[model samples]
Target: MDVLVLIGRILFAALFLASAAGHLTRTKMMAGYAASKGVPAAVPATIGSGLLILVGGLSILLGIWADLGALLLVVFLVPTAVLMHGFWKESDPQTRQLEMVQFQKDLALAGAALVLLALIAHAGTDLGLTITGPVFDIN
Candidate 1:
């Protein structure tokens, strides 16, 4: 169970980590995309979001302040989904469908992040450790 939880954390963090790397490496491209989506201060926002994602992903991955990390993810995902994936504003059916898919994906991730935050708060400890303390407690 501990191993599974650790694996889940790693898997959850991987998406944000990879995305942060992409945002940093492809800053110009990401900024251009953000600009097309009408994001104010697109370039700076891209860079800032990259940093936020990096910090959040690392915190979650390391199990250090996972609650804060989850909150960061919620902050990043909500605006991003609404701003970048505005399916309702799309006129083209294909584009609308694609944007809707992305929006749904973002919402799902946000939900997962919220769940993680709730779990961390409920457990009153870092999620890296077993909720019951010992990993293999049989009692």
Candidate 2:
């Protein structure tokens, strides 16, 4: 069961880790895209989000501060979905459909982050854990 949990954490964190890599490696390109989407301070925002995603993904993967990791993901996912994938603002049918799909996917990821947060909260209560405690801390 613990092994399964570890695997789950890895799988969940993979997307964020990969995205962070992309964000950091393609800063100029991503920032340009964000600017086109009307994001203010696009370059800085991209860099910040990349760092947040990297930290959150690592925290979750290491089972350390998973709650904070989940919270960070929720923060990133919500705004990214709403601002970047605004299907409602699209007019082209094909583009609108694509954006809608991306929007749905982001929402789903956000939902997963929320669930992870809830699970972390429950574990904290049951194991008498604090924010500083590791998720698997049995002591």
Candidate 3:
């Protein structure tokens, strides 16, 4: 399980790092795409998004602020999935299919991040330690 957690962290870090680098290196293209998506203040948003991705990715890679890093990623990617990938009517079927697949993958990754964040936040609580009470107890 520890190995699995480490693998997840590494894989997620790599994905974010690649995405951040892409966005940073392609600022103009990203801005254009954002404008096309009807985003207001597209240029600034693009730049800010890139920075958030870079920072969050680095945090994950360094294993520092893992919970906050995951939270930041969730904040960035959830709206991204919605605004960028949710609507598909304008796209060709093949493109839409691919985008949908990517969106699902992002959603899954975000869900995993959230789960990891929760676990990390509850670190002191015995994950396997059970507490008994009248009716509402945690185990």
Candidate 4:
């Protein structure tokens, strides 16, 4: 279980860090995309999103307050997956198909992040404090 968690952490960290860097390095492109998406304040939105990804990715990689990091990721990803990637539901059929595919891919990544968040949240809750199936100590 520990080894699996470690591996999962590494892969998740790598994925977020790479994407964070991509956004930070391409601020203009990101801002342009945001503006194209009809974001009211594209420049600030771009910078804020980039910072969120960078800081949240680093937090996850460091394994310090991972729950908080995951929460932050969820905050960013929900909007991104819904707004920026809403091309599927808002665009033409031809464009929608392509965009929907990309949206689903991004949604998958967001889903992974959400799962990690849930795991962290469950770690200390009554939810995580349960076991099922046969047990010798059952009485």
TM-score of each: 0.89, 0.89, 0.79, 0.77
**Per-residue lDDT tens digits of candidate 3, residues 68-121?**
777788888888887877646556888888889878887887797787667645
RMSD for each of the candidates: 5.0, 3.8, 6.5, 7.4
Write the residue-wise lDDT of candidate 1 on 1-139 in tens digits: 5567678879999999999999999999999999999999999999999999998898778777777787899999999999999999999999999999999999999999988777766655434453232221121
Query: Candidate 3: lDDT of 72?
Result: 82
Give per-residue CA lDDT, model 2, range 35-139, as digits (tens).
999999999999999999999998888777887798899999999999999999999999999999999999999999888777775666443323354443322
Off by over 4 Å in 2: 125-139
Which pairs, if any, clash in model 3?
A: none
Q: Give the per-residue lDDT of model 4 (tens digit) for 93-133.
A: 87787778777877787788777666655553322212221
Write down the TM-score for model 2: 0.89
Instruction: Give Cα-based local distance difference scores for all models.
Output: 0.84, 0.85, 0.72, 0.68
RMSD, model 1, all Cα superposed?
5.0
Highest lDDT: give the candidate number.
Answer: 2
Ordered by lDDT, highest first, the candidates read 2, 1, 3, 4
The ten-residue window of minimal lDDT in model 1 covers 130-139
Q: Work out candidate 4's RMSD over C-alphas.
A: 7.4
